[model samples]
Target chain A: MATTSLTTETGGFEVRRLWTDERSRAIIFQLLVVLGLALFIAFIVSNTIANLQRAGLASGFGFLTEPAFFDINQRLIQYTSESTFGRALIVGLLNTILVSSLGIVAATLLGFSAGVMRLSQNWILSRLVTAYVEMTRNVPVLLQIIFWWSILTELPKVRDSLSLGGAFILNNRGVRMPSPVLEPGFGWVFGAFIVGAIATFLVAKWAKRRQDETGQTFPMLWVGLVLIIGLPVVVHFILGQPLAWDMPERMRFNYRGGFNITPELIALWFALSTYTGAFISENVRAGIMAVSKGQSEAAFALGLRPNQTMRMIIIPQAMRVIIPPLTSQFLNLTKNSSLAIAIGYQDLVSIGGTILNQSGQALEVVAIWMGVYLSLSLLMSGYMNWYNKRIALVER
Target chain B: MTDQAFHRQQAELLPQQPAPATTVGIVGWARTNLFSSWSNSVVTLIAIYILWLVISSFVQWAFIDADVSGTDRFACTSDGACWAWIDQRIQQFLYGFYPAGETWRINIAFVLLFPALAPWMFENVPGARYLRWFSIAYPVIATILLAGGLGLTVVTTDKFGGFMLNLTVGLAGIVLSLPFGIILALGRQSRLPVIRILSIVFIESVRGVPLITLLFVSNIILPIFLPPDVALDSVVRVIVMVTAFASAYMAEVIRGGLQAIPNGQYEAAQAMGLSYWKSMRLIILPQALKISIPGVVNTFIGLFKDTTLVIIIGLFDILGIANAMVSNPDWLGLSSETYVVVALFFFIVCFSMSRYSVHLERKLDTTKR
Candidate 1:
């Protein structure tokens, strides 16, 4: 027994020694890696400093306040060639947001329709949708942008503008339409809208809970729609018509006295929406197909109508598959909005480029560009994550 | 009573008839598929009418009414598409300002690349392993042939910026990015803390921003970053930016493939006493790459299309050249035709690449039970 104990102790010591050697080797390897990284960082840092000093250029954000001497073709806010660089950047950012938001709404609607049509029982409709998706999605988006811009440019000049009745006008300058301007008491109407929205949300939640308990459905959608739309209309009437319209009138050479959307914005928005819609359509189709036929059949077995089955059984499940890819497309559209630069729409990059050239502060301009884009990306991803969690499979 | 019942059953059982051929043939298919319901039939009729209208108009405009042979803008006054503008400026679009006589050099380079690239893509081709190195080497040869660096009339990078230039930049970026992407992907999955951190930072920083920003940095700020006398061409700047952007996205794709690999594969490699790099190069990458072929091809397609964005930086890529060509005094109002032709070109190339990707996905599918 003593001899066996002695042998066990020796074996333990041997195992411990082996472990120590292995641990030391790992430590050394890790240390070497860290050392290498530190050295590389230091090298880059020094090189940057040396290069900056050699170029006799200052690297700081002080240039943001300097006067931007360049003129923007289109501006969302009041901006001029004499505007501060910061203001110019803001104008660019606002334009980017405006185009992207419009594109997203339009693309989503179009995409959902095409995606549904692609799966139709009718062969012709499905084939047509497939052809559209294939043709549009496969081509380069930049090329599409140029294509649309060129098409817009091919329109007749302001003198020989294409007039659609009297309400709308299209020319090389832009498309002009009657636009609404808010009058007095519009604030009250806006307040009513907010109240209606909140009430609709609460009603929807209550309806859902009541359905869960009683196994009875509610006309939540109709109720919500009436509450939301009717309240605003009622408020508007009570406020004695809270908005006025300015209809465009034809002048000697051009349309006057109404809101005009520049051709650059229109081309960018059209190209982005159509191009992204094609991809989104494919994603939507895939999402729908992912829902098994058995699920729909089961809903039918429960005496649900076709539309009812689609709304309740199919869409809920499809959302799970659709949301992730949809978010990516949204991000892509946002990024692609920068293509407005090509057509001189003065998006963030274009404005930034202008500033960079004007101020010779390339590093500062680039850093700002990176920061804004990165923040936008992060915000989008964060929202998507929250949305995904809401609709995720609730495994007990 | 039993006899009556038996007779009733016998009478109920009539002879079975064959299905009508018309109901199962092309006529039936058209009726059911194209004109099943009233609404469907109406839609079909409308579609046919519209299609006929469009086709006839297009054909008449494109061929019947178009002016085919004139030098000035007034020669294209026909109601149809002016193929003459395209014919007039075809060389400008393809070769940009490259010397007309030396166009053969680009042609020869393209011919050489095809044979070199074909073998690399074909698994059944002989010397498959050697083809990998050849793919790497062929680009160098093509670059020299095009750039004319040694004992030849050197074409400046600025002059070389055109459709072929875009293709070369995209292709070169893809080639350079792949190896870098693989390394970064492996490092991200590595046990080492430093490598993991570095890989994550590199990938995320690049991916979180637009490629335009990166291009801006490369174009304007890269010169500042370099030494005082070091002047890199705009083409080089664009190429570097493209490669950097591609690698970041490729790293994410490869990491996805890496995550998909079963841990047992790694364990089995270790059990076989293969070193880390050997295990990765031999066992892991082959499987991961196979699993990620569809994604890689998609990235390739995206990069190929995105090369057009170089136009924003004043490079005369295909789309850029087309845009410029349309603005020529002789073809001022022909922007629509030029754009249509360019869009068609892009559609063909990108569509084929996507179709090839789908085919590869099917061929490489190994998930069947």
Candidate 2:
């Protein structure tokens, strides 16, 4: 092809040609975008500074070192009202992670069970599950959280607390459970437990290799269980039973000497789990259905039991579909756990809000919340991506 | 041997007979569906017992043992739920602190919503093409009607609460986010690196954080971001924040729809010498948007549910109003009744929306035909 001249009419410059030049246009457009963004950021920064000055607030990390001076009932770490704002926030973060992790575990179990039940052969069970999922999912999660919180709070006061086998105590204030008191000698048991865990991993690896090479299956479940559990038990006995229960005692005004679980945490955990569980069940159901019926039929033809077919054939294929959405659901459950604030769960956001009010560090507090949550989400999605890569079907 | 020979010597097949009682109708359905096996029977029985307990108790609390007619919580003498408080506060629940007389404007706006949205929501509404102008202008019309601009008293947003607040905020987010969502989605799909990166950052950052964080920004930090002299209405600030938050999710959905479009469509548009804007407006977006309608509806459901978060910052959406009642001195112990009513309202609205989405998906299923 003959090269086109830069200008058709050499005598006169045509400015319209500049518009058609894709390269310069792209560069110019990007420059404009960058300039606009810079201008926007400049405007906001100027405005924020002026507003902060006018409000008589000096914006900095200085406020973080100041005392929080607020009571948090459900602190996961050691925190007092006299603690610095930073420490309280750390306590709040730990509490948030605790409730979120608990919610995730409970939600997954509930979701998987409900999802499977919804696909069961029995009609009543499926319909009941459908009703549950619809009802739980459709109502606002905030309402559900508040609903559960209210119910828990409406229970009898601590003086009139309900006792469960002298080990657990329930009241409007909270639930108290007998926590294990570990003596120094229990460290050996812990060490042995870790060793047994390593042994379990090795045994599983060996069993898989043995099965692959020799076509002889090893009963790894039994052997692994014996190693992990029996080792700990034997170590505990050898160490002269160094574990003792710190049983809760009903005192005058409140329970003493036990692990206290606040009503807020229980309510938040239950609500988050049940609400997210509904969505997850839907995901699970869709995933299972996405695996063609012929898959399970083929598994059955190969003389596999129903459970074996589900485990070995259906779930592995279905997981390729389930895992992606399940990741988002887990993230959503974590994010939704922030609703703890509504029900007085002193989570990261709630404590941040308190700190924001106390110190007038609105910008810093909000930024911290956004930064923490964003990083958390990024981390979760990163892990999920790696898991997805592992499970993704390799195709030509 | 004789009996077998006689049976085999039949000259004609017997006329078809009806299935046995045990293999047809309700009995058969019961056998197969409810009691196919011993384990299934046990489960069915357990479910039935649980359902009975739940339903009977609910009915007892809501109706049979309940007192419905009263002026306040005091009028209830029943052992079950005191629905009388709800009856007394029903107006407040529906309209919040919106003045009783001015509710006519809200009523009018709500009525017009059907006609305005009908053209867009359904393909074959009567005179839809002519009504398109009204549909496009609905946000302006609604704002003027609700906020008062033309020959009406201006009601500040603080008065905008309750179920009306939910609808307004939810509707505002839905309306404002769509165009922005489309733009962001297109930007993400752009060939230009600057636009794509910015769009990705904006989308992911918004989506990564829970909406409550954004709400806090609106409540505490948004004002600081504005010029010193400029004071934004808290409700407007919330609407803006929520719209931005939802736009990211909407962008993701629309991007999915865009990805589903064949590359040939873009190539064909380019080959036809269509400018980018012209092609996107006339060719690409319409098809992409059409495909994204179901997902868009699902996003709307989520957004609607999320409007309850406004209550955390002290705005009185339905749940907020319910919460207020729960904490009120007179209705202090009626939290369950109030919450249940609120939950039921949300359930009805959201469940119907999901069903409609499902129906729409089925209707738009091209593979079936």
Which candidate number maximizes DockQ?
Answer: 2
Q: Let me know the DockQ for model 1.
A: 0.60
In TM-score terms, which candidate is top? 2
Candidates' C-alpha lDDT: 0.83, 0.90
lDDT of 1: 0.83
Interface RMSD of 2: 0.9
Ten-residue segment with the worst summed lDDT in candidate 1 chain B?
A: B114-123
- Give the clashing residue pairs of candidate 2, or none: none
- How far out, in Å, is residue B95 in model 1? 2.4
Model 1, span A57-176: residue lDDT tens: 788888888888888878879998888999999998898888989999999999999998888767877877788888888788888887788788777998898888877888888898
Q: What is the lDDT of residue A17 in candidate 2?
A: 54
Writing each residue's lDDT as its tens digit, candidate 1 over B1-369 gives 699999998889678887787678898898888888898888777767777897798788777887887786788776787778667777777777777787777888877776687775656877767776776688888888788877767888778755677678878888888888899999899887777888998898888887877877777777666666678888888988898898888988898899999999999999998978899989999999988888888888788888888887788888888877777787777776777787777778788879988888888886763
